[model samples]
Target: MKWTEVQEIAIQLSERHPETDPAKVNFVDLMKWTMALPEFDDDPKHCGERVLEAIQQAWIDEVA
Candidate 1:
């Protein structure tokens, strides 16, 4: 999926790491994990703080 696919990414993250709390994830690790997702394919340079924030927020929603 693309960087704009926030919910999809969150779902992947949630499923991949069901034991972790998305709210506590740091951008450094978050970005790393997102890149590692099997469906993920994009330039790392495209991600910014706002994109990370959206991913984190979506993850929070996903888990809640």
Candidate 2:
């Protein structure tokens, strides 16, 4: 999945990190975790602050 797949990424992240809280995640960790996904395929440089924020927000929403 690409950076555009924010919701999907968030869902996967939430599922993988059930013990962690989304709001507590920093962008650096977020980036690392997202990149670690087997389905994730994209340039790391494509992840800007806005995209990271969107992913984090989606993750928070997903957990809620």
Work out the TM-score per prediction: 0.98, 0.98
Model 1 poorest ten-residue lDDT run = 1-10
Error of 2 at 1 (Å): 0.3
Candidate-wise lDDT, in order: 0.97, 0.97
What's the true lDDT of residue 34 in model 1?
99
Model 1 lDDT vs. the true structure? 0.97
**How far does residue 30 in candidate 2 sit from its true spot (Å)?**
0.1
Q: Model 2: how far is 33 from its true place, Å?
A: 0.2
Candidate 1 per-residue C-alpha lDDT over 1-64 given as tens digits, one digit per residue, 9 for 90 to 100: 9899999999999999999999999999999999999999999999999999999999999999
Q: In model 2, where do residues sit more than 4 Å from their true spots?
A: none
Which residue pairs clash in candidate 2?
Answer: none
Candidate 2 residues 1-64, lDDT tens each? 9999999999999999999999999999999999999999999999999999999999999999
